[model samples]
Target: MGMHKDQRACRRVDCHDRPILSYGHMVRIAHVTDCYLPRTGGIETQVRALARHQAASGHEVSIITATPGVKRSGTEIVDGLAVTRITAKIPGDLPIHPRTRHHVAAALQENPVDVVHVHVGVISPFAWGAIRAAYQLKIPTVVTVHGIWGPLASPGYRLSELIAKWATWGITISAVSQVAAKTIERAVPTLGEVLVLPNGIDVQDWQLPVRQHDSSTLNLVTVMRLAPRKRTLPLLKIVKAAQERAGITMRIHLRLVGDGPERSRAESFVHQHGLKNLVSFTGRLDHAGIREIFAMSDVYVQPSVKESFGIAALEARAAGLPVIARSQTGTTQFIRDHQEGLLAQTDSGMASAIASLAADRALLAQLGEYNRSTAPEQSWPMVLARVDEAYARARHLD
Candidate 1:
């Protein structure tokens, strides 16, 4: 069966007066992603949020993902959303599932979706397979780029983009940030028209009362996966350098949150520098746990130089904690330098910014207040409005 743009846009699907779309009719949207709830990352969070928002808007939403350890593959209802999980062996970061194409086809046939949105990445067997299946089924497809790309990652990413371009028809492409869109444009020059769909967070959950720090000891917090691109080890070394310079006059305590591939290396570096007294590693924590930590911290630090969208940093800002991040990253798009937080070019610069904030609590409070006021605009409703526009464009109605 083939899906098409509605001949006449409906003013209401059933009884509500809300127009289906400002430009098109309502659709049963199917989201295909490489990872989901069991896996924790920025992409997982955004996908889950978008699905919830779409369902809340009265659209039937279905999620198709790989079940890494499940013995059986089947449909399940998760928080009012329909999920079809396909059993597969996931080795390393990417899951290699040759059966994904068959699974996707079966799921779509059983569920019958109107729009297929594939969240694309470098090694996404399920996502790539879903895109091909949607094309074969003659369903409209949208590919949202979720992979981070740079000079180092470009070779493989360019290859993947070329393959994607050749594998599907009438596919609309979207990126999570302006930086990501530019990267896609550079990687696939022939694949014209990439939309920028920025990631969003639950602002209400992060709207905490301003944190209070000890007058003598300043608390620094960083919540990120301990990966190479995150620069967690280097960040710890920078903190050690700052503490060494501060000596007995200044006291600095760093609380590192989240666990990842580089955790062991970061821990070794901390031990090598004799920073056990200054740095505390709290492994992985849930949203509530992270919010509690944010409520206690004086400042949030983002060390990743290759972030497509700094969701964690944005969450910290919404919690009324001033951010200090690398100026070269996508975080700069949201957190203005010297306004909401300080952006630094180098490790030494970041250290200096942290030390300055610790010494001046009033300036930090002013920045936090400004961020809290502006952060609500990055909520799920704002994100879904843009997603609706993207869906309209995908249907060739916009």
Candidate 2:
């Protein structure tokens, strides 16, 4: 026989040549990821939002993920979508479910989805299995790399880069931002072209927060998982330095609004640096609680060193709050320095920016207003429209 159909399916599609789907046909999409809620992070948030929108648009959508903890397996419905979880073993930061291939095959055999949408990361065993199952079942596949792979330039990550590249071969690949696309293209040159699909938020859900900034206190809020790359400790130090630099004129209260593996270490760093008075960690909050917190905050801070896209920052911007974040991040794509908010290059620069914003409430209000007005374009519908093109490309990637 001529080459098997699975082997022949490795051909790639031209980046811009995918035809847009004419209205009326609803595609059944299976979103396969390594993690999902109640575990919170950028990927989980985006996946949930995408599934919700896709379902609302009259398409059948389901999220397949590994169950957290030592449980064998379970299934639950959240946001009107079915979330299927399989038992897995946790290794280091990533989870490795040895039976992923079998579970995915089983799921495909039963439901037979149209597209297997896999969310890729540095080390995603489950996602890898989903791709394999896609090939086995002859299902079209779309793989989105959500995290930054630029740091993998080091020798240690060379093997991982090759493995991820190999697994993602023959798949329609996408990144969350232009910077992210460039990063992944550099890491995996053979992937041909990577599309930029920006992370989105439900802007209409985030009503502009009524800000009554207390002159006596400057509230700096950061909503992110307390992971190592997030630089939560550095954020605390910056808040302290900004307070010290601003003098007794204004006190800076830093509210950290998430939890992660690095929480204990972050708390230790706070106590060691005598930041007990300035910092408060609010484990994690749901959307309503987070919106309430954002409504009452002055400025939002993003101190992450390895951010692919800043969803939380965008949400804060939508909430009418000026953001002070590190420069050279994907957030800079939407938030221009001095236009929407201030972007800093270093810890010192971030501290300086914080103090400056705190001192000039008028400037803060000006930037916040601009960000809130411009933030609507990053809404879920706009993002999903672009994603539809990617889905079409995945289907036609002969």
Candidate 3:
């Protein structure tokens, strides 16, 4: 009887004309990530945005993520995506990977998805379980490598590479950025099928009314974790140098918006350097708050010695703020030397770039204009379309 109804439904012209079937509903996808909401980072934001967009586009979308300490029992629908958070034993206060085999096995049995997309970063036990479950079920998998793996060189990297090679395909967010892509390819040559999809921002958010600020008082902002890799101390040093080198006596205010293990060190650096008057720390904030900070700032600077995509810089560009970023890593891809924004390779170079932008109002306005024009191309909608296309190719291969 069910078969007869399904056949009749398939034959009905109205049913055949449904948007779901017409616009790629034939593909059911399960997006797997180690961290979801509550745990914030570039990877988490990308996963949430991609999943929300995919679900809204009529694809059968679901997420399998590790539950935070306060576990929510059972599956919950969030923004139309079914999110299943599984509990895991905390080994010495650290949340290990969830024993997801049984839960994933059950989810797969119920839904029988077509493909699984894993957002790779911060290798936890849960990530391992997801990889194992996907492979055991004969489901084709695609892993998105969000960060460079060489420096970490941990057991997690080896395990992640093994799973990525076994998966149907591998993808890197900064594919066009040679540095980021090459790093991954070096680690695992079997990841040759990797495609780059640059992280995007909502262009609409960048269109906010530019806060009127005195050009003489430059408001510079860097939104990143207070870690050694971010090179926040160097940024503070550069700001101090700017005051002396430029002789402008500009009231340069540096707002650092993320906290980490290096928070105390960063704070101490600010005090030791007597930059307490010039720098302020606003603990990590939500996306909206970050955007608001960008909207008010005259300039955005990212000094990370190593960055995969530098999503913060992208967000700043979308907000029409002139950016001064390091030329190292994937940041160089978005910043054109003297064209869209300034790129500095060394501490002096970064300081010089910031000073130059501060001294020239016309140049700052031009860079801001260029950023606004180019930001729309990197919107999440376009990025997700590329992602969906990649999923289609993975499905075909399967």
Q: What is the C-alpha lDDT of each candidate?
A: 0.76, 0.77, 0.70
TM-score of each: 0.88, 0.85, 0.84
Where is model 3 more than 4 Å wrong at Cα? 1-26, 69-73, 92-95, 122-124, 150-164, 167-178, 210-212
- Where in model 2 is the C-alpha error above 4 Å? 1-24, 68-71, 74-78, 88-94, 150-169
For residue 180, give model 2's deviation from the true position in Å. 1.3
Cα lDDT tens digits for candidate 2, 184-238: 7766666667788888888878866465667788888889888877887788789
Candidate 1 wrongly placed segments (more than 4 Å): 1-25, 69-71, 89-94, 163-168, 245-247
Instruction: Superpose all Cα atoms of candidate 3 onto the true structure and report the RMSD in Å to 1 decimal.
Output: 5.1
> Which model is ahead, 1 or 2, in terms of TM-score?
1
Top candidate by lDDT: 2
Model 3 — TM-score against the truth?
A: 0.84
Q: Name the lDDT value of residue 219 in candidate 1.
A: 85
Task: Evaluate model 1: give its lDDT.
Answer: 0.76
**After superposition on all CA atoms, how large is the RMSD of candidate 2?**
5.9
Q: What is every candidate's alpha-carbon RMSD to the true fold?
A: 4.8, 5.9, 5.1
